[model samples]
Target: MSNPVLEIKNLHVWYRTYGGYSRVLDGVNLHVYKGEKVGLVGEAGCGKTTTMRSVLRILPEGQAHIPEGQILYHGNDILKMKPRELQQVRTRGISMIFQEPAAALNPVFTVGTQMFDVIKYSGLSKEESRKDNIKRLAIQAIKEVYIPDPERILNCYPNQLSGGMKQRICIAMAIVTARELLIADEPGTSLDVTIQDQVHRLLRGLVEKKEMSLIMITHSLGVARELTDRIYVMYAGNIVEVARTSDLFANPLHPYTLGLLSSVPKLTGGGVAEGIYGRIPDYLRPPGGCRFHPRCPRAVQRCREEKPLLRDLGDGHQVACFQV
Candidate 1:
């Protein structure tokens, strides 16, 4: 097995609101190895983004807190890092590709101005007419993402470019830094199918060529299959299953995972895809035992009263379901 570049162990997170604290993640455990592509897939509000933000220690300052757990990158705990060290970790270790490029990119600035600012802060262009070197690197990164007209792209504002183009710009910004890990949080949100496919292909190729680890946060099982080596199926703030992508797809162990795979729409004509019934449980007062038991068709008495630990079945496949 590859060395673990990032390890999240028994993670428990909570968000403070006016009403009370909402338990967002309950003893969640995830680890990504060097040069590995891992996928986190679940419905909205399932703590996918929370896990990524926690690693960066960039959670809403006073609104979120990690009551328990550890996030270690390269053997250093990010939660305990001083601000200066944390800043170094972000710039030199991890890069993030956000869901919406419009919000991620500065609306007031042109692409050239924004990318130049990043290159400046990166300390990569310190000598010999910084502006010229920054522009050259920015153009090269843009070209790497398969953008045909790098000069035209740099002159345009976020609003002037299409959704696909803006997303590509986001990828360019992320790749130019040469960080060790890239966390893509719904990187294909607003694009059409063809464009989304292009984005996924671009990300896969870039990660491989850069030899960087990737944490892909997505909803589509198809995208997960295409990009990830391993998959984690999350439901109600907990991981229900973890396995190799092909193994999980061929023989999904958890009921929640099976339900998720069934929910995907098919191109061929058929009856509507069946969705898991009931809404995500209230986080403030989540169900007592297993979070997925309420929606799982195979739930038993033990499933409702006792929580299941993620136990390895074989060949590194692990699941937290009593029935499995």
Candidate 2:
């Protein structure tokens, strides 16, 4: 086993809200090994996006604060890196494909302009920083993602392209520079089913071809099952369960994980799909013990008093529930 490309240790992130402070991410522990595709699955507001943003130190400066935790990229702590070192990491080590392609792309700038700028600042050597070389690299990247007419597409503004095209452009930009890890935040959420499938396949192929570790944040368990090697089930701000994708689907331990698996719609015409009982708790005043205990069907008295830590069952299958 080689070293992890990225490792997050007990990350705690908070935001200063009008009501008080919201504990957005609480002691999140996650790691992505070299070339390993990991899935971060949770309902909305479960801090999935926040955890990834924290990895790049992109959280709102004044509003969000990391009281404790370490975001280690390779062996160094990202939380303590200087600006120049952090810039190096962002340009050469990691890249992110945002959830909304429209928001990620500058509507005003032509795709060529944006891509050229990215390549120029992508930690390229001085000899490779020429305008002609950058344009060539950009075109080649767009082509690799199966987007035809790269030159014409680059000349167009973001709004001129379709949703799927914009997403491919974003992917092209993310992979233009060689990176060790890529964080994809629901890249296909806004696309049609056909386009979503294409995008998913494109991502799978790209990760394999480039040998890049990936942290895919998604709401669709089906998508996670298809694209990830392992899955992390999150509840509120805690990771309730972690296991290989096959093992998780076959034998989920945590009650919350069970609920999530049960909620997935089946093709065999099972009655109506059942949803998890309760909504995620309020972050400002979250549950004291197990965050999911308020809705856990098998919760015990200890579940209401002690926060269970993730304990390994076997073969790296871990769950953070007292009953389990």
Q: How many clashing residue pairs appear in each of the predictions shown? A: 0, 0
Per-model TM-score, in order, reads: 0.96, 0.99
Backbone clash pairs for candidate 1 read none
The clash number for model 1 is 0
- What is the alpha-carbon lDDT for the whole of candidate 2? 0.93
Task: Please give the CA lDDT of all the candidate structures.
Answer: 0.90, 0.93
Write candidate 1's Cα lDDT for 72-168 as tens digits: 8988899999989998888889989999877999998999998987777764635833778889989999999999989998998999998999999
Residue-wise C-alpha lDDT for candidate 2, range 111-225, written one tens digit per residue: 9999999999998999999989999999999999999899899899999999999999999999998999999999999999899999999999999999998999999999999
Worst 10 residues of 1 by lDDT: 120-129
Rate residue 277 of model 1 by lDDT.
85
Q: Name model 1 segments beyond 4 Å from true.
A: none
